[model samples]
Structures are given as C-alpha cells and as structure tokens.
Target: MSYVNQSQTLNVTSEQKYQGLLEKVLLSTLIAMPCCVFLFINGTMLFTLRSKSVFRGTSRYILLYNLLFSDTVLLALSQFLYTLAASKIMLSYPVCGVFTMLSILTDEISPLTLVVMSLERYVAVCYPLRHATIITIRNTGVAIIVVWAFSVLNVFIRVVLLLDFPFSDLESLQMTDVCSDIDMILSPMSDIYDKAYTGFVFLSAGVAVISSYIGVMIAARSASTDKASARKARNTLLLHLVQLGLSLSSTINNPLLLAISKTVSRVVFARMQNFLYVCFFILPRCLSSLIYGLRDQTIRPILVYYLCCRLTLSPQPKLRPKIHGVN
Candidate 1:
C-alpha cells in the first residue's frame, strides 16, 4: 500500500509539471508574436528617424535612437526567452547568470534613460536660453554614458553577490530564464539593505521622472509663446507622467503579486499574479510601438509607403527631392 501511494504521488507531480510546461509555452508564444512584430516596426522608426533632416541634431532624435535601441534589444530578448521556452532549453548555471545579469542591467538602464530624457525636456522647455548652454549634445552623450555605466556597475554588484552564494542548492544548476530564485539571492542582504535598495531605485527613478514633467508643465504654462506650443508641451508632459505612474505602480505591484502567488496555495492569487505580469510587462512593450514609434511623422510616412508598396498592385509614389536653398 505504501509503495502504491508513493507511485501515485509521483504520477501527480509529473502531471502538474506537464501542465505548467504547457501553460508557459502558450504564454511565451502569445508574448513572442507581438514582440517580433514591434521589433520590426521600431527598426523602421529608427531608420526613418536617422534619414530625416527634421530629427537631426535634436535631443528628440537622440532619444528616438536610444528608445529604438532599447526596445529592439528588449524585443530580441523576449523572443529569445520564448524560443527557449518553446525548445524547453534548460540553461546551465553560467548561462543563467549571464542572462539574469544582462536582463537586470538593461531593465534598470532603460528607466534611467527615460529619466534622463525627461530632465532634458525639462531643461529645454523651462530654461530655453540656459538650455543651449547647459544641455549640449556633448553633455547629453556624457549623461547617457554615465547612466549606462552606473546601472551596469550596480547590477554587477548583484551578479557578484549571486556568484558568491554559499547555499548548496541543486536549483542553481538548473536555473530558469525568469530569474526564479530571487529569494535565494536576497538571502545575504539584511532586511534593512533589501528594503533600502528596493525603495531607493523605485522611489528615486519615479521622483526624477515626475519632477522633470512637473517642471515642464510649469514652464509650458508660464513661458510658452503660443497656445499651441503650451498645449503640445502639456500633452507631452502628461504622457510622460502617465508612463511614469504606470511603471512605478507596476514595479511595486509585481513583486507583491509574485510573493502572494508563491506563498499562497490558492488558485486565485496565482491567476492574479499572471494577470498582473501581463498587464505590466506585456502591455508596456506593446504600447512602445504606438507611443514612441508610430506617432512620429517620418516613421509614419515610411511605414505607410512600405505597406502600400507591399499590399497594393499600384506603382510606388516618387518622393520629392530635397532642394538646397542658396546661401
């Protein structure tokens, strides 16, 4: 009877594993398709932006480049993870460490870039005369390099700590792509350190984004020359504010949801966690194509032109040649 009971338990466990695998495969497939499409779209946006005279030498152009680069990298990463899921490529410890390190670094770096962009906009709108003196291309490039270096250095600390983990766990040998064993990695941190670090990153990033937008809003309302300019600035400020809000809320909410899903045996919390992750990660990537790429005039024309050429039997329209005015 004891042997029979043990065999039945093993069967049940195997069934659960199979079900989880199926669920993960389905989710990854759903995530990968949209990300792949957007990756191409963002690529075109980047290309079009580079080829245009309107975007050249502007801070917006630099931001467009960074946004496209970040999104492309992120989309490629998502596709890679999904491919791994499809193949069920269980990674080794070294591969897992590298994957986790890159993911964390990139993830942190993107927000830092956004924060820098917000500050750029703030200075440009709020202090127009001072902006020319303060926020030059050289300074912007330096700031961007600093942000990348800092994020890399910070995330590298986490990577080093992960390497020095004293635990004797078999799970490290068969790591998943999602950075699954965060709790294990956090073991060395005192309660105070963990809380402090989390709060600092989350709060500091949020504050920087918000404050920049607020500065923009005030400057737009107070110093703008025309109603249209003011309105445009207001819209831009609000959009950034909304993006910051969603990102901050999602950042705080995801870990809590994940914690609940792990600690609780209820199906309800598990479903909730899945829903929240979809809302947060999946939604943001999907929206980036529309928000950052599709809205640009240069990109819109190129995309429409390409689509028309591909979809229609009609001949392509000739683009007007650039005329150089006499100096």
Candidate 2:
C-alpha cells in the first residue's frame, strides 16, 4: 500500500509538471507569433513603398498596402493585450474600452478593405480595358479614406452608445486582472446593435466578394485567347476567398464557442476559449500577411528579394534602365 501510494503521487506530480510546461509553450507561441507577423507585414509594406513607380502607383497595391497596414495594427494591439494578460496586469475600464474599440475598428477595416480589393480585382480581370480608367489611384485613395472614416465613425458611435446604456455602468462591474474576451459585456440593446452591425458588414462584404468572383469566372469562361491569364485570375480570387473565410471566422468563432462552452466546467472553458482565440483570431491575422505575400506575383518577387537581401546583407540587383530614343 505504501509503494502504491508513492507511485500515484509521483504520477500526479509528473502530470502537473507536463501541464505547466504545455501552458508556457502555448503562451510563448501566442506572444511570439503575432510579433513576428507584425514585423513581416511591415517589412513587406516598406519594400512595396520603396518601389513607388511600380507598386505604389497601382490601385491593387494601394488597397493591399492599406489592408496590410490595418492587419498590422490589429496584430500589434492584440499582442499588447496578450502581453498584459500574460503579466497579470489589469487595465482600467476606460482604458480597456479604448483598446477594445480600437481593435474592433481595425478588425472591421480589414474585411472592408478586402471587399474593396476583391472588387478591384473583379474590375481588373473582367473589364481589363476600363480597369485603369475606372480604378485610378486617386479614386482608390478616396475610397480608402472613406473606409477609414466610416470605420472610425461607426465604432465611435457604438462605443458612445454603449457608454450611455443603463446596464453598462463601468463602476459597478468588478475589475479583474486580465482584460480578455470574457471581460466584455454588452447590454441587450448594444447586443442587438452588435449583431446587426456584424451581420450587415459581413453580409455585404460577402455578397460583394462572391459577386465579384462570379463575374470573374464568367469573364474567364468567355475568353478564348487568355486561358493562362484566366487561370491566374481564378487562383488569385480563390486566395482572396480563403482569406475572407479566415477573417470572417474570427468574428463567428468566438460567439459560437462561448455558447457551446456555457455548460462546461470553468477551467475547461477558459482553456478552450484561449486556445480558440489564438487559433481563430491570432493565427488568421498572421496567415493573412503570408497569403498575400506568397500569392501575389508582383509582391512575391519583391518580398523574396528583400528577404534574401536582408539575410545576405547584399545589395539588390538593379533593373535595366529604360532608354529613350534621341529625337
């Protein structure tokens, strides 16, 4: 009996140690991956910005750059919150509310920007001759500005209304050490508004993306001479669809998981929630940057060349200069 008791104790101790190690590993990954993603995205944006003549002037690259910028900001904010949570630091209600509002703004902007990008691709692929005239740099810039302004206004209004809600008394709520998804609560009216807002934005964007891709397919099917170009267009559209799915999942997954986990043990729910947060929210943001860099023909070469130059500490090869004929 003594030996058996000792063996059982030893096994329990070992399991506890393993669980502790696993949690640390996960925390480290949750912290490190977003930082790496932010760096990679900003680096690629810098590279694109440097080649202004080729990339900066194009409408597609302009939309893509904005998308990158938004995603980078989102990742940075997420990392900041993650670090604070890891350190067991609690933000005051107002500060947490600000961070939450900023995060939502960036989150909304990402998918909205993607919607514009898909529409731009649709025009480029389906209406090749008119793409340049229609999707001009100035027009694209104006559209981007509108997107930012609208996102800011929308989020600000929602936050203000939330503050005004009778049930949303920040002073009455207990403050915790970690500002996490579970800490946020929406009054009934705000909850309704949130659902409506999410549905409208996501549904509209989905419809636009789906319609644009459908148009691209129809155009590709009718074209006889540019089969290769059509295939490339289809591939790019598929990539955009994948990215869209990933972005939408971040919005949908959390609520679904919360509903399902309601009856589960608190310990299990907490672990599952954190895991899902990292998988659905953080992982998708990181992959978005990778997907864009790898899949974009124009950006791919530049990203690869920049990475190579950085790794080797060597100057990039210069492009052959255009020569003008003597008049």
Across 244-293, the per-residue lDDT of candidate 1 in tens digits comes to 55444445654687578777776567456556655765566556556755
Give the best candidate by lDDT: 2
TM-score of each: 0.75, 0.82
lDDT of 2 by residue, 1-327 (tens): 999999999999999979966886686686677677556766666566567587878887888878777777887788788777765677776678788888888888888888888888887787778888999989999999999998998887777766775546445554565775435545676677777888988889888888888888888888442667667767777777878878777777658776868788855776776677777767777776677777777777777776665465568999877779833
lDDT of each: 0.64, 0.76
List pairs with backbone clashes in candidate 2: none
Estimate the TM-score for candidate 2: 0.82
Model 2 scores what on Cα lDDT? 0.76
**In candidate 1, residue 123 scores what lDDT?**
71
Q: Model 1: how far is 301 from its true place, Å?
A: 2.2
